[model samples]
Target: MIFDSLDVSYGDMWGSHQGMTHPAPLSRAVAARRHAAGMEYAVLLSSRERPLALVESWPRGKWRVYLFDDRSWRMQMIDFKPHRTGMLLAHRNTRWQFSTERERSSFKWDVQETTTVLADGLVEMRTEFAGPRGASTQPLHARTSDRSSVGPEPVPVRLFPAPVEDFLCPAPEFGDWQVFAPFLAQQGHEPATTVVLNDVSVDEGSGPLRATEIEQLFSSGACDTPDGPAVVEPVDAGLLRITSGRLAVSDPGWIGEPRTVAVPPGEFLVTLSLLRTTYGVDVAAAKVTFSDIPPREWEMALRPDEDLGLLGEGEFYGVGVDTGTVAFMDATRAVIEDELDEDLFIPLDGRFTVELPGAESEPNLIAFRAGRGDGSYPVWIGRTDDGQVGCVVVDFQLHSSGAEE
Candidate 1:
């Protein structure tokens, strides 16, 4: 769905009109607005109008970014793909330059314009966003040789958002969510059904956890990890090794540009939600707790700088579990990339210690099985009653389906 627009000045960067040429006439500017043109806005002015800023992405060569507002009402994201021909190559990249339409503007990139150079014959050069201004404009030559070539086909980088109506859900009142375990329990269905999402136990914590269960979920051959001689050594000391690592989660099998997170640094307690169904035991979700305080307002686990937004019934951001697996490690190390999806049930890992190359000590990697094989899972940031981060949770939505995988 069309989630974002970088708010670029609409230019005819793509598409051809009848008898028209590149850079379509200004009258067709509306059509051009849907282009991930070779540009990024230094600032966005219409803040009140476009408040939906929630970015999301997948590994299938598609990029979608969203940014949420403070009130946490709506979301916005920009998704586009690169055309094989070099038409929108610049626009095809994942633009991490984020904006909340606020005062500060830090958008940076090479603002390129073609120029004829008699010294090097007809040569094209590029310049910075501001360097090209002033009377003494210094045309900065590219660090690499020019690659201004196109293929036979012109694949338009589809930079557009889906209709807002597409996001409308028959959801309940939006905002901070309560512990849903009680509500889900009320919907009694079958035996061994994946019921537990949040801690439904007698108010104590979720677990002390067992090594056997951890192995089945995270240390199995199905999950690729560091295994040479000490196969289950990490599982033996899983809990101790688990919490000592990073707060960020990751999709170990993710295919494209690695999706990572800069997590809140602190000591975390690792716990699992092993929900049993007719298909056998499954890791429904996983929890990494930092404080005993229950989350007063749960927000999507976005980067610290991302503006928080209230989510509706079916909106979130987390890691994409493509291999039916997800991992949690230190964020500073870029060891994990993640998504914290909703649906409180948990599970999912077997933590192991591995001495990574160039690293001093062995950092823990909590790899766990995702609930429903592979899909985007949301990681929820549980804030303490006092608005502090108490925990981080990734829900697999096992209960949503009928005791199935």
Candidate 2:
């Protein structure tokens, strides 16, 4: 697919940053702003996904350019000495003249390099540079794939002034941003956050649908969040319905819960919810539970030779604890109990005489709280000979959050 825009930046010998950007209508405008602020930049553009132009402004007064004639697949780089007028006027007039060039024979530029490349589907052009400080190579790649499936087409380059107020606003050109967002953010430009909820599977469908398709399926409008106005949309996917919102969160202390939705019988729903903030983003999996499904027929099964011991009970407790296991448990009771607060009963040593959907039938099923603060504690259930229920915990893991101590 043809990318709407691409930006690359590097540090020069003087420690000042230099940037190269491609195919963005706002690139020239942003370059002008940066140039006015004393930052060097090179704005690149492509016509019909071919290298069209490169405007460079460095050391203030001197301007260099690389122009491409798509019809002839020809390219030429030149250094243009500005008029005696101020740098800003010289830069603007030069840009306007280069853009309005009608005939190739009328071009007036000091040629530096020229080459011709076959205009295939996607092209990669490599250019080399050498100076007193060092040598470096820059590569330019462009694609002309269909963009209609994703979103709106890019805004064309216009000489008209860009609206500064809309610089941070969402634009149609920034379609399904694969690179634009991080590129702008790296340049200290804060673009509007685009929240995408993907891998959404409905009970009626066998595969996931795109977020844009889901948004179109549902009616969308504005809603109020703790931070400000947010857009909320309801997506109906046959047997399931999902409501999603896109907004910014200024306060990190805000607390929210997942909304409960009813699901039809004999089906499953798995989806992801995402939120993008200025600092970073948050993601959560939607949890779906069924209340109408009947409980599996079985009972808690005890080992034939194991003795039932008493474990202290406050809010919840378990039975059939071996001495060694019980001692270990008692030593870490505070941490274990704090993690297992959600369960009514914690099985230390026991097996449920029940048949699990995806498990093999066996006895002596043991169970315990597994995983760290961010992981899951899954219960294992098995069947005994006497038709009793036995359960067990097979594995436990602790995940590191990578937080500083």
Candidate 3:
């Protein structure tokens, strides 16, 4: 994972010994190098070469490192915590820092000479790497644990991109979106697209949306308008209210430190709600509605007397008695193909009258009984604007008092 060390070319003077350890004897020298009683190049005395620990003359603590070239430099270390009570310093000229956890657990680093403080009263140590001056030395302090002094844990704040710079991508945030019927219509057959927070972008004439050159609008600010919340009211008058005001959307931790809310996905009418004067101002609730319009009559047709038995298959064309005044109908279609799902299908206080121009004055039975004796009955067909189909039934009753001529 360390990109820098991936391409290190070992020189002849440096020979790598995996899982190698030397017994103490003080031979004065070995190969072309020599080590005194306290001096050594690299030591691997642990049982295994894993949790591999490096024994460089250096201090140890929690830290993050970036392997640049063949050198391991500490990039960030806010507050490091050491596991063991030991000091880290560099060797005479060949000290190295092992960053891999695979090395830390296996290396046995022994105690070396500790430096005393003069004025500050703080003990410190100077660690070496590569050569005597190969690494930097830092002031060391004793680690302490204070339970009573603990404060609330710091909540994590994440910037979309770490180390934000000028001309780079601007910080992303949510925007307020209002409902517009025209925009909703553009949604086509797909479910209405609800709006959500998106990155600041500009539409270019050609290819894709290019990054805008202007600065971010709501980096920080607040405002109270006489009208209402910026993203509160509907954007377009054409947009019909579906759900009067039963919708809301929120950010992660909009409540406490880490909260999440639900929001529909689609292009929306939004406004800048983040205000500078206010503290922690946010768009909490978003109210939205869907369109609901009763289907209108489109067209109508007439069916022959012979076609009466074949009902439900086609629209109710028209009904007429053979020898009676035949009542022709002006066919009108149903707005939607699906039957009304709710009892509300027959709108409350809403009714329409169908006048049969010609029909038998008196009622009859037998062949006139339109129903199949069960609940099923013959029907009339009608069509609607969007090719939706509808049906109506025509039943005949026999009147014993008014006998047919």
Ranking by lDDT: 1, 2, 3
lDDT digits (tens) for residues 260-350 of candidate 1: 4334554355766655444555665676666766556665666443322211113344577776766666654433234323111123333
Ten contiguous residues with the weakest lDDT in model 2? 246-255
Runs of candidate 2 with Cα error greater than 4 angstroms are 1-30, 71-74, 86-405
Q: Lowest lDDT 10-mer window, candidate 3?
A: 2-11
* Candidate 2 lDDT by residue in tens digits, 137-212: 2211111343234433332222333332222222111122232232223222333344231211112211111111
What TM-score should be assigned to candidate 1?
0.35
lDDT values, one for every candidate: 0.36, 0.25, 0.20
Give model 2's clash tally: 17
Could you give candidate 3's per-residue lDDT for residues 1-405 as a string of tens digits? Answer: 111111111111112222222221111122112111222232211111211121211122221111111122211111112323432111111123444544433432221222222223333333322212322222122112333434332222222322211112211111111111111112121212342322222121132111121012222322233323232211221111112121121111111211111222222222221222223222211112221222244222232222322211121323332221111111111112142212212321131111211123321100111111122111222233554432221222110111111
Better of 1 and 2 by lDDT: 1
Give the Å error, residue 200, model 2.
31
Output the number of the TM-score-best candidate.
Answer: 1
What lDDT score goes with residue 4 in model 2?
37
